[model samples]
Target chain A: MAVFVDLNISHTVDKKRLQNIIETAAHLGYSTVAINHVVDLQQKKQEIGKPKCVSELFDQFPIVQGKSRPIKVLNRLTLVVSEASHFRPTNEFKSYDVVAVFPKTEKLFHAACMSFDVDIICIAVTEKQPFYFKRPPVNGAIDRGVFFEISYVPAIKDSTMRRYTISNSLSLMETCKGKNVIVSSGAEKPLELRGPYDIANLGLLFGLSEGDAKAAVSTNCRAVLLHGETRKTALGIIHTMKKIEPTAERREEEEAPVLKRARTEAV
Target chain B: MVRFKSRYLLCELCVSDQSSLQLLDDRAVFTGVRGAVCRAHGDYGAALCSVSFAVKYLNADTGVVFLRCRKSHYRILWSALPFITHLENRGQKVPCAFNCLYVGGTIRTCQKFLIRYNIQQLHRMLPHCHNEAERLEVRRAVLNCSLKSLEKEEEEDE
Candidate 1:
C-alpha cells in the first residue's frame, strides 16, 4: 500500500527532530508529505498594529523545490481559515499534488475550487480538547509538545471546525481523520497519533463510507502525492469558470425587508 | 441543532417536503460570518451565500451556530455545483483529465486527443478540463477581489 505521511514544516520546528520525522515517515515507505502550517497571523496583526495579512505567507514554498529532500510538500496552505486569505495559500501552491486546509475556508474553497490543480487533504482533529503548544517548531514561543491539554473554553463539537471548512475533499477527509482538523500535536515530543486505519475509522463513524473512509487515509493521500487520481467519482473544480444560475426572484422579495430592518438595528 | 435568525429577513425559497432544510419553509436564513452587521440591507443575495444553509432555531440558548461544510476539500465544490448540475441536466459530458469524458456514472471510451496516458506514472495526469473559460474566470476573480480588498484597506488607512 502506498502511504503519504502528513507532515507540517514550520520555521519554529526543531530542525534536527523534524528531519528525523521526515526520514522516519520516508523510511516507512510514504510517497509524499502533505505540508501545512497555521501560519499564525498573530504576528502580522502585531506588526501592522492592527489585524493585517501579508500576501507573502501565501507564496509557494521555495524550500520544498529541491528533490533531494525525501518529503515532497504537496499542500501549501496554512490551516487558518479566514474568508479572504484562506484560498490564497492553496492557489499559490496549487502546483503541488495535494492542498491542506481546515474548516474555515469552506465557502471560498467551494467558490474557488476549479482554480486549483490538486486534491484536498482535510486535517481531521483527533483530540477532543483545544490544545496549542507553542514550542520547538512554532517560532511564536519555540515551545513544543502538545501545548494545549485543557481549556477554559469548551472544546468545539466534533463537526464544528475552529475555522469554517472550505474544501471538503477526499484527501482532506483522510488526513484530518474526522472532527479535529489537525495533525500537529502542537508539541516537540514525538506523539504516536492514531495511524491511517485508526483515523479512517473515525471518519466512517462520522458518515463516510468504508471506501471514502479508507480513501481519506490511504488512496486519497497517495493520489495527492503521486500527482493525480483515477476513480471516476473523484471531483475537481475550476475557480473562475462557474456555471451561473438564475436566482429566485420571489425569495429575494420576501427576505428583502426583514434584512433591511435588521441592518438598521445593527448600525 | 436548529438556529434561526428571528428578526432578520430572507427571500423565501420554494421549499419542498424533501428539501435539505425543513424548519423555515420557503426561507433561507442569511448569516454573515464576517460580523459585518449592516451587510443585509445592501446585498441579500450575497448575504445568503453561505457554504451551507443555516436556519435559525428559536429554541437554542446560544446564538446561531453555523453548519460548516466539513467534508472533502471538494476543489471549488460549491462553485462547480451549479455547472455540474446544469451540464448533467443538459446531458453534456464533463471532461475528465484522463482524456475520456466522464458523466452519467461511466467514462466514455472516445478518447480526447489532448491528453496522453502514461501507464508508468499515473500521477502526472493532464488537465481534465477541455476549456479555459473557468481558468480565466478564476484568475480574474482573485485579482479583482484581492485588488478591491487592498484598495478598501488603503482607503481606511487614510
Candidate 2:
C-alpha cells in the first residue's frame, strides 16, 4: 500500500500544540507529515529564514497507526509569491525538505506552473479564486510533475470557505483532469486534521475519480516528496553517497590472496 | 423477486472525552449524518440519502453505530461521514468524529465483522494487561462473544 502523507501542517510557535497535531496525525495513520513555514513576500521586510531541525521537535516520534513505524516529519517552506521578483532561490531553501508556492496573481500562477522550482502550487481556498485555472498552465504543471494542492481545513471550518474550496478545486480538476493533484490538510489544530481515507473520500467531492482521489493523498504525495528531493539534487536521477575507506583487515585479506597464489605457483 | 439491497456502515465515534459518547443517540447521529450529507453533496445527496436511511443500532459504551442506507446511495453517506465534526444533543454540541470500521451489504454481515473487530481489539489489548485478573477479564470477554455468536448461529440453523 502507498503510505499516506500530509504535506502541509501549518507551522506554529507553540511547541506543545505542534506536537499535539503531529501526534493526532500519527494516530490518524499518516505515515509522513510536513510542517509548513509560509513566507509571503507581499509584506514588507519579508525574508526567508532557516527552518528548525525536524529531529529537535520530538525525542521519540509517535508511531503511525497500523504501520508499526515512527512517523517521518519533514520541514516545508511555502512561498506566497505575488510578484516575479518576490521569490529568490537562496541557501535557506535547501534546509527544508519540500518547497511550495502560493501564487496570488494569474501571471505568477502561470510562472509557477510552467517553470517555478517548487513541488506544490496551493489553490486558494479562503476566498474566491480571482483567476480561472487556464488549461495550458494547468497542463504544463501536470506534464512537469508539479502537483496542485488543495487544502480542506478551510472547508471544514466554515460553509463559505467550503464553497470556495470545492469550487476552486473543481475548476482545477477540470483543467488538470485529475492528474498531478494532491489533497492535504493545511491544519492548524489537531481537530482540523482528517484521516487519510477521509481525505481520499473528500477528494471525490472535489471532482477527482475514485482511483485519483486515493492517489491525491498517497501516491501523489509521494511524488511530491520525490520532486522536493530532486530540487536539492542534480535532476533527481543522480545521487552521490559518501565512499567508505578500506580497513586494515581488508588490506590483509587482499595481500593474503596474492600471497596464496604465489605460494601455490612455487609449490 | 429481486429484493432491495442496502448497505450497513459500521462506524466508531471518536471523541476527546469518553463521557461525550453518552450524549450521542440514534437521533443525533442520524441528523448529523443527514446534515453532513446535505453539506457535502448538496440537495441531490440529501434527497438520495433521505430514502431508506436509518440508524439501526447505537452502543454508547462502545461508541459503535450501525447506519443503514440504500446500496445505490451508500457512497453518498460514506463520503459524508468524515464531515460530521460534532453532534448536537439537547442544545449542547458534543465534538466527535466518525471512524468508519466496515461497510457490508447486510446487517448480519456487519454484525459478524463488528464481533471479529472487537475480538481483534481485545487481543491487541491483551499484551497491555498489567495483572492476571485483567488478562482473564479480556479472555472472558472474548470467549463470551464467540459463545454468543455460536448460540445465534445454532438458533438460526434450527
Which candidate leads in DockQ?
Answer: 2
Query: Which 10-residue window of candidate 2 chain B scores lowest in summed lDDT?
Result: B119-128
Candidate 1 CAPRI-style tier: incorrect
Winning candidate number (TM-score) = 2
Error of 1 at B116 (Å): 42
List residue ranges in candidate 2 displaced over 4 A. A238-267, B115-158
Q: Give the per-residue lDDT digits (tens) of candidate 1, residues B1-158.
A: 85432111111111112222223221222222222212211244234444343332211221112222212321122221111100111233222100001111111111111122222112221122346986566457645754466456535632
Per-model i-RMS: 18.2, 2.0
Worst 10 residues of 2 chain A by lDDT: A234-243
**lDDT per residue (tens digit) for residues A1-267 in model 1:** 435354343323454554444443342334455434444333344221111122222232222111223344433344344454533432234333333433234443343332333234233344321322212212211111111011100111212332222122223334323322222212221122223333343343334565655554555444444433211112222122223454666665666566545545543
Q: Write the per-residue lDDT of candidate 2 for residues A40-153, one digit (tens) a residue.
A: 899999878898988999998977766668899999999998899988878688789999999999999999999888899999999999999999998899888999999988
* TM-score for predicted model 2 compared with the true structure: 0.85
